[model samples]
Target: MLQRLAFILLAGMLGLAALLVLGIGFDRLSKVRQLDRLPITQLNALNDGIYATSGRVASDAGSLTAPYSQDSVVFVRYLLEEEYTNSKGERKVRTLDSGSSATDFSLVDGTGRAVVSLGLQISQVDWQIRQTHRQQNGSRIYTEHSLRAGDLVEILAHFDRSRQRFELPDRVAGLNAIVSHSSLKIEGGKSLLIAGLWISCATGLLAVGLAALLVGLGIHRYWVFVLVMTLGLMAVLWTIGLVQLKKDWQIAADLYGRRSAAVAAAPANPAALADLYAYYLMIERSASQWPDSLLFRMAAPYSFRVPTLPQDAQNRVRNRLAEVQSSRFAEQNWVLFVVAACWLLTGLLIHFALRAIRFKRLVEFIPTSKTTGLAYGISELFGMIEVDDRYPPLLSSVNQQKCVAYQYRIEEKRGSGKKARWVTLDEGGASTVFWLKDALGRVAVNPAGAKLIFPEKKVSHEGKIRRTESWLPPFRSIYCLGMAGIADAEASRLSLQNSADFGMLITTQTEQEVVRGQGALGFLLTGLALATSLLAGTVWLAGAGSLTPLDLLQVSLLVPLTLALITSILHYNGLVFLKNRVDKTRADIATLLQRRHDLWPQLLVTVQTFLAHEQDLQTALRAVRDGQTGASGQPQNIAGQLAHERQVMARLEAYPTLKGNELVQTFVAQMTRNEDELALIRTGYNNAVELYNNQIEQLPDLILAKSFGFSAAPMWQG
Candidate 1:
């Protein structure tokens, strides 16, 4: 049986790997769907931040010579590959070199041309030149992908005013900065197909492996591994959940305490009453994370309405907020707690099961439509939210960001240390008409009387008070199900409004995510419900003398196994957190690199204006700024520009008059701050890398490290 378990373990690992691949495929599919929704922006009238646009390829600094093809082109990428026979007599190919020309290029649209950087992910290369030849080592293949003067390509990135070029957008930092000739729709379709293939092939293998593993296990020990693993995972999840619940409780208590004090201090003040309402909404939001037990929600506010300020500010259930001191979650009744736990699990089972079925049915049967193709009836939309610029935007209380619709909330805290409890203070929000936009077009969407489904509530804490906010921020992609009607009959324009049957449903989740989450949650809850019942029955039977001590004690080995597994899990989690910290540091470096964008360009212009008389020096700087190289061969990229700035600053300091210039002095001061920021990023990044590397290389952790393939990150010498 043990040997069989070992074999099953190998198969299970393979299945898990296959599942991981499948998950990646689904993720890619989701990303492709989202990418397809972005409307193309005109190059001339570009957005201030990230935008996608298509244009013809051109170059200001003439064409670059393709190393392999020897053809002159505006921009080019080449891949050198060598074919070889593997140990298993299978044909394999390895890339010898994958390099691209390092030069600034131009993307010309109908309106205008924008400067583009070469370090972009060439997703759909034209591959103008392809050659194969027999070499001394092996059969060599050389492919050159060229972007000539007339070739149209799509670029989705932010315009860097400092370097005067476009790099990859920070939002999609996880993906390659894709530059494709194909339309976003076409590209997305291809990506979806590839993802389907990945899921199909992987799923097939996983199914077969699991079948064989199950057969090998036979009758007696059939579900032993599955049972043990499930139980272990459940324990871990429960532990995490308990900790989270405690945190939520503390947050709620903090808000309630403050709200009570505020109400007492200024009971007649309408401002204080509004503040009280905001606190209730936030308290409700926090408590929503807890189980839907009647007792748990006894102290938590049901809901709040922050109507036109000072207009008889009222709450739906005033009792929930008014008597907020007593919380059922704080009570330690063992019997009541047990009963609540069972009831909670049962409720979750029913809720998730129904949701899984209902959501699946609705999505599959209701039919989805683009904003461009809206009819005068039901419409299911997957697009981005666009705030109607005509109206003043609402502000989120926590982040304080501008939004189309928002719920601003604040909770007041009172009491000392562990005895603290929070009360509702104030809550306010706006949900007016907005636009639902897709790649094709945009349509009006009235959020009034709509069922808004926002996932995360932005939360923050300040001395004696807590604030939580939820909002439909501008350009937030969403999946909406609502009734459509002809708003402008003459124009034949449709608008999303409340339906008599379906009402209006808007969520900040993609359709695929919604389906997956619903299905996964339902399945897990069902299993948990069954597991709970089984355990309860077993305990009952044991107490009733239906089972002997030996029968009950048969699984004694689980004790040490559970302990060892728990310890390993803790270590593994620590390592993962460390790795994430390292990743954050790397991301922070990229963010810090852009901090001096506005300053750098201004500084450059100021310095050049200061030295108006030095024609030779001016000419030299222009040449350096362009494609021309100086004595140090000044780099043209942002990093290289920083180095060049250092040299120029030194030259400026050498001249007393130039150094004293007011504009130069201001820029210099700002540049010093920028340098300090860069210094901190460098320090943080390298330190995180060092710590992660050490953790992965250390004793007990290294076992999991190697298993996870945690290779050491390169140290930054900067």
Candidate 2:
């Protein structure tokens, strides 16, 4: 049950991650296309909406120095990261420091200059300098990237007149405020650069997701469900966030309407005038809070102390405010939608993590013990790690520790505190096919594609450099689960040419011990998932906000239903993983048998050709010596034929370079290759027959085999 659950969860997680990436990619591609259509305008003729503008970043004496490169720059964002491994044997990259700085700068187009605010969003800044510093710690390394001044840039932002600066309107709160309140602002083309960055980020994420999905989906169908569910949930949540943003816009508009009416009434008394001035000041302070047209008209009448505006003017102002607010509202909803999508993505990751623990438990099911005497097909074999001459061992990269297989990584800290992160500098590993020795005998084991596990390792640090390494030292006990057979030799080994399947693993931990650990982890994940689901359901029930009891009940029921559905899917996937092993075994046996059949005819023809060239005197003597008589005096048996051919070859070897003798050498070469293949086929066929026979003769598996039409296969006798 645990194994099945884990398989399903893994499949689902991988699938969801893939779909999320694809959706992000499509969305990014659309944005990039939109940005591409934007015309680059001169600073003097800059419009209100988001548009591209190219200009030289005005260098100032007050511009700050970029940290790493010491370059003079108007703005810079720096980050430091460090890498470390947690107790669970997983490597984690953490941020150590990060900060950004900016100053007011003027953007100069060929025609004119526009003052731009440095506070505008900058998506991807071209870093003038990126340098790596090797710290004393063996496990960690550091690198830095920064942007400097005097760089040519393309800017995208709405030109705002209030702050007298170009800014990212999306960064501000409220739909009406962003659309009707703030004007386009740019400083070094940062805001439009931000838009380009978002599109690129989406595209990158989508590529990763699609690659992961394609790789995992080939192993199972459960990933398909994962992708569909993750995308569906994200879409639903995004729509909800947009709806909320729209509601906020309506409330803001209503407040603006009431404030506008009071100003137009014209106060007569000092108390009334004081009240009106107080209201005017409040509006002025939060200038971006109201619609653009409304704030402008409100300021003009009140700032100039106009007693009463014309009726036609008031209607015009009101209509213009409504039109501007509607456009802003639409514009603002996209930001909310992105936020909702990001939140749902985070939620899905958490969900996948919870399920991953359960799936990991399935690894414990891989067999670990003495497999020498057992019938082959697929078997788990246990042994101690050893080295062989075929592939020599090498010293580990970081620590110089001698091992048959070693993997190492180096990371550096970038930024400080909450904004810090660890980035990888260099990483690689080397491995070779080695030996696994036990009481049964020494078996040739392939370490390639094996999930290697090592003992606890302490990291060594020297100054800023840190290093961590993992290796399989000689004499360490190991477990391998794969196809086992004794081919052309006495010792039994697995015919593993590539990486093993997930269900079949090669690990250092014992099966029972690993199972116990994975089981504990699975239990914890299950508890967490259940608690989260229940909490979500309770929150829905308690504060559905004006929703009827029936509607609330429907929403509440969905939580458990969804949970149950997920569990069922995982369980079903597990069954598939288990059943596939049996099917694989059958297929392997059939393949070996087919190969033997194909090779036997070729071998026979070669032997016959060699015999036909020979001119022998003892025909009757040979007939009598070998079992030549078939039913009604036909040809000899295959074994008898092979014996006769060997005798002929022995006689011909005496005559060097003869026509028939040359044929004998060719026969010997072909026969040697043919014999090696036959030996492997014979061993695999015999083992498969034994395993199949044993399975059918057993209890539960016997019933399954019978139901599935797993009849006995003939063993090779020749």
Candidate 3:
């Protein structure tokens, strides 16, 4: 009965937290809507409300030097942190310094320039990292984000015509503010990445956790219950670990926001107070909206580990850690130490598992391209391995089968009876440079830094010895996902290799098979994690005596429900991601459409330069300029732009002289490129809408969508 009551209480807490997270997601979606409604405007032709403008950063005032890198820049913010493992074996990190420097700068587009004052609190700047380095400690590094001269940046900010400066609007606490890169992509609220983690871990772990919960409940063993409770404990600590993980960025942001807020408050302006909060979100929002681990972020850039300060001052700033004390009589909680070890192991497993899941999703998200159609950036290809005939093929050590790549293990039986185990006699693998071939073409593949998971496996027994082998035989179908770049430019062959931008993965298994294999491995690791947690609890319980069913009931109800709520946030976050994608694409389309209107004069002048008839040109221009709103009810007048392009084409055809005219041809080609780009953006917007609608229509997510009144996003009919 006591356990039942605990469940009820924890349920309330879970529900409350869920509601809070849901509220944040909903609020972000609303803000995205507002920003989406606004059009991108040039600085020279500024409007009064929220809009995005792209321009080169320039300022008359002398630039400030970046603290560590010493680069002269208009604005710079940096954070320095040190990380080391503590006596408890827990990862510990401390912030040394973090701050921002800014000055009034002008955003210069060819049309004109607009003054962007640092006078406000909310400098919602997604300052790109200017300089960085790996520290001597090799753990914590500081990043310097800045706005340097000649930076072509897009700023989504409110331009208060009355104030003649860009500032956060007083009406909303959240800025619809997003830099183009903010995918700054304002990426719907908290990053969808977090939502994705919540969803994947929530759904993945919840399913696995419940299965483990069932096994525990069925066994009804006190030790078993202890294991579940132990995991619950680690779950809490894992959160603390994550917090410690993001602390540097968080601290720096907070410090900047607080100091900026204090200064902004002196003027008694609403926008000033609003900006204080906005800067806090810049780092968080600037993250890519993808379903990946938060722990997988790039290490901060370089900063000197040793301070230039005197020894005494340095000692004062960097306090020496307390020495770990030894005591024979002191009672040590073995559970803490044991769980820490298990947690670390579990973390590594989770990281590997998450990578598999990420790759699986990438396979689903990005369509496989023909070899000839591969882009220079991240690409996926389907093909068969074609050996480089110049070199002899790698022969499998076990079976002596001719192969392109192979791994074999030869093991001998050791010991006897209950202690008998397999002792490896020898194990090795070999990879030869090869080509991936499809119907269209083939590309060279370098196997350096690749994680190869082959499909075929064989285990053979001979007396007391056993041999196991897996290999990608020549002509077998293969799936290659990696960074595609130039290998031999003159030969016109592309090379597949690992780069900092994307990971390299080579698999003989099909995409579906690879995904399933990853799922199974993740499940096995999760089960092992449960086993360790249980072992930890059992070890601790050996000294502490027993547990009751009531205890199991009390703890089980609270942890799973909370974990469920935490993880299930994926759908909502996915919705936010989709919404942001749509918004970003919409803004882009609007910019192109506006360019069409802006470029008509150039097109008209080019035509008039050689030909006659001003009346026809003016008439076509007016038709194209008739701004018609799209289905989304935004000011993106796609119809008018379409009419203008159609008119340009029809008018051009009327004159034979304009067909091959150099300037006329250039304008025509530019218009064609614009049309193609606009088509792609429209397609992207529609895709986002479809995903959004599908998410809201799914189970449980549908309930949340209804609660939040998140209706289906309209497709681009424009």
Point to the candidate with the largest TM-score: 2
Candidate 1, superposed: residue stretches over 4 Å from native: 1-348, 376-378, 389-392, 395-400, 449-462, 485-493, 499-503, 536-718
Candidate 3 runs further than 4 Å off: 1-476, 480-506, 529-549, 562-601, 611-616, 622-640, 677-685, 704-711
List lDDT for all candidates, in order: 0.55, 0.46, 0.54
Regions more than 4 Å wrong, model 2: 1-366, 374-378, 388-392, 411-424, 482-506, 524-563, 597-718
Candidate 3 lDDT tens digits, 607-656: 66776566777566555545433323253456554765686678777777
> In model 2, what is the error at residue 180, expressed in angstroms?
24
TM-score of 2: 0.39
What ordering of candidates by lDDT runs from best to worst?
1, 3, 2
> What are the clash counts of all predictions, listed in order?
30, 56, 9
Kindly report which residue pairs in candidate 3 clash with one another: 122-275, 132-302, 133-301, 133-302, 181-184, 182-185, 198-567, 202-567, 227-534
Candidate 3's C-alpha lDDT?
0.54
Error of 2 at 623 (Å): 22
Q: Write the per-residue lDDT of candidate 1 for residues 1-718, one digit (tens) a residue.
A: 6645764785688567756764665455444423432346566544234445788878687887877767777656678888888765689999889876545578887777788765554432322221322233348877876666677877666555445577653343233455666554455444544544453344334433443354345422213434533454334324433443444344344434543453455335554444445454434533332242332465445322232343335553344444322111222253244445654664565455445544543454345787766654445898887765554466765687777667767899987566578888998777767777899998888777787876547878988788888887778888988766546322235678885545688899877655545544433344344334333332332222222112222222332343354336545765775676567556545554554444555555765677677766555445444532222211123455567667766766776776788877887776676566555445445555676788788877799999988778776552
Query: Candidate 1: worst 10 consecutive residues by lDDT?
Result: 627-636
Task: Kindly give the stretch of ten consecutive residues in candidate 3 with the minimal lDDT sum.
Answer: 321-330
